[model samples]
Target: MAFSTIKDSITFHPLGDAAIVIQAGADIREEIHERVKQLFTCIEQHPFDGFVEAVQAFTNVTVFYEPYTVHQAAHLQTHNLSPYEWVKGYIEGLLEEKWQGGGQVKRRIVDIPVCYGGALGPDLEEVARINGLTSEEVVRIHTKGTYLVYMIGFAPGFPFLGGLTEKIAAPRRETPRMSIPKGSVGIAGKQTGVYPISTPGGWQLIGQTPLPLFRPNENVPSLLRAGDEVRFVQMSEKEFFSMKEAER
Candidate 1:
């Protein structure tokens, strides 16, 4: 679907009974992502009486709320609407209002050093074969492009990044690995992402970074978040190990 069409008529749908989804676009584009982040920021800054939290996704924002509090809101009693409807109306109002401080979001740039090929990137050869390119070319192309974090999902601090060039695009493996090491950078279709924690995945592994994406003890647990830009810098095995040891 065209982004302009979706932008003209933003959809509002209920997620079960406690949450509502505000769809900003039909496809994943930076403009659509900007709209989603803008709405997310607006909602986070100006929450309703029952608002809990809002999660930003590639094309929409899912808002969670306390249903009982919404139902008990004295102001909403006159409308005789359900909690979802009340929240929807509130968000619709927000859409019409000028965003106070959401004109632009501060995008953070994070450079992650990666060791490509060898034991760290077991599927590197496979990815090169699939794309009809040499392993060195794959690394060159992958590192040259900057990626945008559309959202964090599947695992804690796992960023679903966009901006992967079609030249090195590779499909997911037919069978997913039982456990992919944390910080493994992989490509699936047109997207690339890092496994923040050790987990099962099927993306074509091309490299691995030594950085810790998830920090359980920190106030902000995720090293990366939605709207951040990631740059991959190639490193040698010796450097990777040195950095890994330094991290330890």
Candidate 2:
């Protein structure tokens, strides 16, 4: 949805006993996404008494909290509303306080080297054929496009990327594979992503990247996060293996 709609359009609903979801707007537009980031950051900056964590998605922020503590918080005594109402009001206040265009959401540009076609991208030819283009042209278009990390879900560190070129878009495989190797890039519908770990999936295979997407031991476990910009670059198989060895 547009920025003007944000004033009275936000919907605050409870996600269960201990969580609340604040929906800013609709659609997958950058404006709504940036507002999501802005609201996420606002909550992070001034965490309430029982606030546990907040998960930011394309258009909403799910806030987890300790219900007991939140209900008993001395600061919330002024509001006679229930815990859900109290939290909603608090977030609404924050929106009014800090929602001044939100500015440009800070984003990190991550470069991903992908070895496309051949065994790595078995569906590359099919995807190209569906779009009436050669595999080389498909790779060129995919590499030229800039993607946004809308959210990380499905698997640990598996980024749900936006901004894939519509030219090479294809449907998911009718039958999903039991084991898709980690770093395998795929496209389904208008979205694209990489498999952070071996798992069952049906997105049409496009390429593979050797970079580790998740590192639990590190301070930031996921290589990419929501709002980050991703640019995929084509690489030769020889360079891909060489870089893999260098990383190891």
> How much lDDT does each candidate structure score?
0.90, 0.87
Output candidate 2 Cα RMSD.
2.2
lDDT of 2 by residue, 44-76 (tens): 998989899999988999999887798898455
Candidate 1 accuracy as TM-score: 0.93
Per-residue CA lDDT of candidate 1, range 117-234, in tens? 9999999888889889999999999999999999999999999999999999999999999999999999999999999899999999989999999999999999998999999999
TM-score of each: 0.93, 0.93
Stretches of candidate 2 above 4 Å error?
1-5, 75-80
